[model samples]
Target: MRIGSAASLDELFDLVLEAAHEAVGYESASLMTVDPAGDALTVRASRPGRLVGTRVPVGPSISWQTLERREPIIIEGPADKALGTTYTKDVPFSICLPMMVAAKTHGVLNVNRTAHPGSDVPLFLRILADQAAFAIERMELYGDLQHFTGQLLSQDEEHRRRLARDLHDGLAPILVSAHAQLQSAGVENEQVDKATALLRRAIRETREILGTVRPATLDDLGLVAAISAAAREMATESGWTLEEALDDPGPLSREAESTLYRVAVEALNNVKKHAAAHEVRLALLKNEDTLEIDVADDGHGFETEQWGEAGVRPGHFGLLGMRERVAFLGGLCKVQSKPGEGTTVRIVVPRDRLR
Candidate 1:
């Protein structure tokens, strides 16, 4: 709140990133500015060496809730991603923090992650966002603002989902048929073994597609079972060791269950992407009344303090999305990381908050 007016735009952007990075341990950080046209936001600054100078349209974004309502909108997760979910029309997983100075809507500030930022980051984001809004609003430039990293991220995700689906629907069957043909053929020598290996590879690709498309089995079975399958799949694919400890999970509210699954999905994605450790530990437990999950890795941890302001890594929406999703559920998410020590994400939901 005490950031001086004399501070340069570069310095203010630094403060924004520092606030966001310090709030949550994101390997990447960004603060986007809405454009004057009320149509797009550009990533003016992002982590060092990151390609974040990207911009996207906000004319059709749901985060426009800030512009429409003139306030902030907090989102929980992708539970609302059902094909026809209203309010989520063409936009998913974006939380908007409005910027208003002198009673004019100069622009908006957007912060996001490729993976889910924990619920822990929002409060800090909300605060630092206000500071950044003031700084950005104060920047003495003409068409001064970049708007929607939310849109870019959402679109990218939509593409990933679509690509994953295409891989499943467009190519998975062909691979399956090939596997069947190889099995029924009379080739029983080294050729058969090679065919068998090819079939295994194809099946693995299909599983990867399914994982990307939001694991179907997750919806059929409960979160615990689905996440266990994901962990095992990760281990099998990467040869990394995984340790799982889950108790008997009772029937959670549909929303609660969904939140758990999505958060776990983000956590596992992080483990796969950043956690270089060969061994991972996942634990889900009901501590009498609270629902808690801990995903930890003995990998090279990230330095929370080094991230710059303006924009996060071009594609890193994990932490930002997670934070928004958990906040919607009234749950709490925390991340602790240390270089070489490891990184751990703890998500805790109070029983009373379950819906």
Candidate 2:
């Protein structure tokens, strides 16, 4: 009745079975939810006791007709000896109702009466069906939310992979070439020391950009080597000293490499952009089956939840993107940050996925 306010699944099942029994006065009343894999209705709850997960084959149950028509089905007296011949024989009147949500039927609510269920039985069956339909809608809505979150997380990871590739192949080379030209010009204009100083500054800028642009070294090397290289570069450019401890060897996958690389890049960038802290720590540790890449910044931190979807910011919009990338690889990306305290980003991908 008030099942929508149910606190537990068992509580909700109790409501459905109790209503089915009181209304139709059937010898037994049972609830069968749709089973996609079994391609039939599998009993979930019953009044006279259930054969838990009992399946009524898809082909011949009168439930199929109710589901197909999205309406109540009544087999008065005898059902013309049609589908469910054996089941119909045991009961004088059979009623089936399709449980629906948003006009889509998910399963059927079946009621059978050993004694003829007069017209009132049909109306009562409708009430039980309504309650069940609401419950199914709520469940389906919850399922939709889970599916959506998964998809969003997946899409984010794909975006990061593309961003990482762009930073490496697209921007890194351009900046490197610019640095070479600046160095060459500095050599040629030594007579003008001020001009030479400007060239040197430009070269330093290119190096800083390279720190973020370089290809994920983990993919080329392994996790340890890649993190080590990234640590050196981030230290050199941002002046935010970083300490790193890497464990897993060259066996990690290309996707894992990309994931760790993105995590470091985002962590270092946060240090330079907002952390204001003087140092950071990067660790790639393995605890049994889970591989965790941890990036901690000593700088001032902010509320992780308030960062909005995928962490929003202009010019330096990478953290949210990094989380998305981690999710796609069947991994989790978590950021722990408190204002004026510190910030830590953890990217943990499944070991099997890496394998």
Candidate 3:
């Protein structure tokens, strides 16, 4: 009953196993959680604590059957005759209940007792398993919420840094030169002209900063044209060969356009900063219901294994932002690279999701 107040999955598992052993009198019990890949379930907590972290394939196991049916099952007689499995056959009575969250079976809770249990055992155990399922689902949603909040905070800090750099490098010098010219009492026509030119450069720099915040071209020319112009700009600035093949996917929602544009910008910036490549390629293609933006470079690649759990490199904060942006649009972002080879980043979103 107190399982609802558990703080983490580990704590919940421990509480559930203990409750089942003490209150339910199951004698032995275990809780297993499905892996993210959905291929296997690992024992998260067991009464004996010996089978913790033990993973078993889901193929043809009673746990798999329970998951498939999305219900609880009971077995009588010997373990081999009851469950048809060599593993854990010594236990005479067994019951397995699927842990469900919003119609999805996330895992299974298994209990074993010596004698044949009545119907009340399964019912009582199912109630406890439901509590555990709700706790796990809540924890998963809370974790996702925390991750997105962190992503937003990271983006806010990055934006501040970019603005600071823009002012220091571009506009500050122009203002200093203008101030110096004004301080001189004997200012000539040439001095006035020079000051005027510096003022114009300052205006241009400010406009560039605004553009960096949110490109006016994205709203004016649309996603495809905006991406093409950005690609050309990057190639000109870096002096790298640029290849582009953009298929007009028609008009997308403003959110989709912005997300795709930002992802492309991040990819191109990475190429400029990290990739010492002589050539780069960008392509936007629409196939059926999917729209894909692909960027590839000939630069020296990195080890793909360095990517963390979310498919973004640990120190590459920009890539993480790109992934978060794509995910918000209900899309997938993939980055692949291998040492001595090259690197490619792809962003794929569904057409319907864009709308």
Candidate 4:
């Protein structure tokens, strides 16, 4: 049997309940998710749909026994009075299966019927419960991964901002002072002129580095302004006819603004380096509760099927990194391209999440 592709915790619960009903018939079925405190189980999904949100504390009940024993518990008599439900009380036969993965009980799957199920039903239910447990475990691990990645990205950006500030405030001023001293020395020697010229270049390059590291426009202005600045720079360098439809997204958290700006810059850089087109369209729009940024290029497109292989090429990891960054913000990054068509990179993030 296929297993383990449920997207969210709720969906996993519904799948487990549905699978229980299909694999072994049940008059009523419910999936209980273990609370974070591990002291109770909450009915997240049920076949009758009325038991949702019902909470059952860990007590001397069959469900609790199944969880503790890490096995299926078959009850042939009246429903446990601790359940405190007329629907459960009416059902004379029930089975509570522990959803265990790696010797850890995540939850319990309860199935009730008026008559006893076949002798092999427990085995099948146990298998189904195990699969559901594995899916839940995988989903939890993925959630943890996304949280860690978000933290790492935030820290990395903070480090870059700090380094940029040091260069702008600490190093750039020293270079400027050196240049001024050389100019005031009243020396027309070729060596002095060369030294002064190098100092000026260094100052100029330092400013450029500061801009690239963390653009001041991003913090002072906002995401739209920062993206427009980046887009114009890339357009000038690539000689692409740039069309922009930027809208102010109002105030956003520092992290959200930074993530959007970096993703936009990466998209533009990819176009400048790889796309041999003459036209590019950049858009920053706030639609409903979402903030969207789109970078489309009328370039010679390649098969998107090669996206994975392309990421391995030199200077192409940005494509994958862009997606990961957006995902970290609970957003989506979509790349649509076809040969002889064009390429469009769109990122949509929930506005509330930005806060």
Tell me the deviation in Å of residue 217 in model 3: 18
lDDT agreement with native, every candidate? 0.64, 0.67, 0.78, 0.80
lDDT of 3 by residue, 100-201 (tens): 976878799999888667877788888888888988986886677456444433576456456546654775566555555564546668846665554544
Better of 3 and 4 by lDDT: 4
lDDT tens digits by residue: candidate 1, 214-309 = 445656777889888888898788677899999767777776776678788788888788878788899998888788899998888876555554
lDDT tens digits by residue: candidate 4, 34-127: 8999999999889899999999898876778879888787777765465443333467788889998887889999998876777888888888
CA-only RMSD, every prediction: 24.2, 19.5, 23.4, 20.6
Tell me model 4's lDDT, rounded to 2 decimals: 0.80
Clashes of 2: 6
TM-score of 1: 0.41
lDDT head-to-head 1 vs 2, winner: 2
The reply for model 3, stretches above 4 Å from the true place, is 79-84, 157-355
To one decimal, what is the Cα RMSD in angstroms of model 4 from the true structure? 20.6
Question: How close is every model to the real structure, measured as TM-score?
Answer: 0.41, 0.40, 0.44, 0.44
Off by over 4 Å in 4: 1-3, 79-88, 156-355
Among the numbered candidates, top lDDT falls to: 4
